[model samples]
Target: MSTKRYCYSCDLKNDSKLIAEYKAYHAAGNAWPEITKSIKDAGIVDMQIYLTGNRMFMIMEVDETFDPVKKAELDAINPKVQEWENLMWNYQQELPWAKDGEKWIPLEKVFQL
Candidate 1:
């Protein structure tokens, strides 16, 4: 299995609202279930989410054959997923380096074990 880490930052001031939005979006929209289903359908082996301070992280172990671009396209096409993203955007602010509609920017790995 191969693993990847996704990192994103939230505004300190908007953290509470962002967290609330995340919870509400997942709970009301059944987003977590859908996400899990999609991941499993796409042959992901394992996944985990974590947060620290204003930083959010997701670790995923996906099948070697998984196509990221296709998965991204599928995400965009899911109405409930899109709705969840829209809801979360209300409390989300772009990072200093992000373009419009981008809530989280990827952090470059400068060092790794």
Candidate 2:
């Protein structure tokens, strides 16, 4: 399967609450459905999220016909997706290396199995 990875760090404040919210959001499934719709609309395929310590990661299997730049452009104009992001941002903080409006950064893979 094709894969892509994204990584981001979170601020320590309200860490427990943030984790709880992440769990709850996933449990509800609506958040994920919304996200998957966005991805599919952008021509991407299956995706998943994982966490390790303070970092969050996303793995996506992009459609062979997907255009990454176009997908990003479409993502920028999606109001409902933006609304979801804004809600989550309530519990999110800018990481030390992040610029404004960036919640997660695309990570370069150094090694993989």
TM-score of each candidate structure, all chains considered together: 0.67, 0.75
RMSD of each: 3.5, 3.0
Q: Assess candidate 1 and give its lDDT.
A: 0.63
Tens digits of per-residue lDDT for model 1, 41-80:
7766765556665455556667776676787788799986
Instruction: Show model 2 residue runs off by greater than 4 Å.
Output: 1-14
- Evaluated at residue 11, the lDDT of candidate 1 is 43
lDDT of 2 by residue, 1-113 (tens): 55443443444234777777765775645566767688787656676667665456666666566777787777778887777777777766666788887766677677879
Candidate 2 local lDDT, residue 81: 79
Enumerate residue pairs that collide in model 2: none
- Model 1, TM vs. native: 0.67
- In candidate 1, where is summed lDDT lowest over 10 consecutive residues? 4-13
